[model samples]
Target: MRSNRDRAILALAVSTAARASELLGLRGADLDWGDQLAQVRRKGSGAQQWLPASAESFVWLRLYLEDLGPLGPDAPVWWTLRRRERSGDVLERRPLTYDALRAVLRRANTALGTNWTMHDLRHTSALRMVRSQRLSLRDVQVVLGHAHLTTTQIYLVEDDQEILRRVHQYLADQAEPSQEAVASESTVGYDSNDLAVLLGGVPR
Candidate 1:
């Protein structure tokens, strides 16, 4: 079974498409419970952006936070578990680092026999949003915090099968007559050669 912390991490990664650094930099105060959104600082741009958490993510995140007990607004949303200095047997908390986050994902993937990096989760999120057809490219660009629409276009690569299906459908629609009356009515005694000519070609 997956731990609550793991679930929360995966959910946020796939839901927000946030960078590893942004995820690691998240603070308790950045989360807006009322809006179900988290504010993050984008890399390079250094601009603040807001990402909405899915309902499932919110549930897991809540569970993980509850396990942390009371924390100040400045405390890290995700913390590392460390051994206590005095008890040695007891575990203490510290800020989560990129390496620590990577280790957590690696451990989770070991049982599943998969090799996925943190950035892959971002790409997965982008593809899912595009395939869903619910949001426009502009909307996806905004959600992903991409500065250029061209960059967002790169994320919308379609499957070959899907492309073929759409092309076939478009051709079929274009070839279809507006009314049945527009079609030729002299098919009573048409030969194979004549049918081939009408259809442009015969199947080999």
Candidate 2:
């Protein structure tokens, strides 16, 4: 079973495409339940931007918040769970650090047998929005808060296999009309040599 923290990490990464530091910096006040938006601090500009939270992300976040119990607005959204030594098995809550987040991701990667960094999840989200969801590049740029369209273009690269499939489809479409024409003409007493000439070939 996945922990609340783990679920929140994955959901926010894929849904919001927020950087690790930005995500770690999130407080309870940043999430607006009614608006379905999370206010994140942009990296370079340090400007605050609002990102839409997906329904799936909202569900997971709500479950996590319930487990987290009531907290003040200034309290961190993601808290580090620490075991208490004095108390007979009580978990203490503290602000989750970047290092702690990395450790959590590392453990998750080991369990899943895949090497995925936080940024990888961001890229995956970008590609999914562009390719699978068929969203515009400008839309993705807004979601990712990219300053330039060129940066968003990097994420729009099509897969080689998909490109090849399209090429094959085009070639098949071009050949079909010519093949049908040749078949129809051949039924009118045209020999192989005449058919070859009709198809732009010199008779042998």
Estimate, for each residue in 175-199, the C-alpha lDDT of model 2 and write its tens digit: 7788778888878776879888899
For residues 8-47, what per-residue lDDT tens digits would candidate 1 score against the true structure? 8888889988888987788889888888898888988878
Error (Å) of candidate 2 at residue 154 is 1.2
Question: On a 0 to 1 TM-score scale, where does candidate 2 land against the true structure?
Answer: 0.75
Which residue pairs show collisions in model 1? none
TM-score for candidate 1, residues paired by index: 0.76
lDDT per model, in order? 0.84, 0.85
- Each candidate: how many clashes? 0, 0
Q: What is the lDDT of residue 185 in candidate 2?
A: 82
What are the runs in model 1 whose C-alpha is more than 4 Å off? 84-90, 164-204
Q: Write down the TM-score of every candidate.
A: 0.76, 0.75
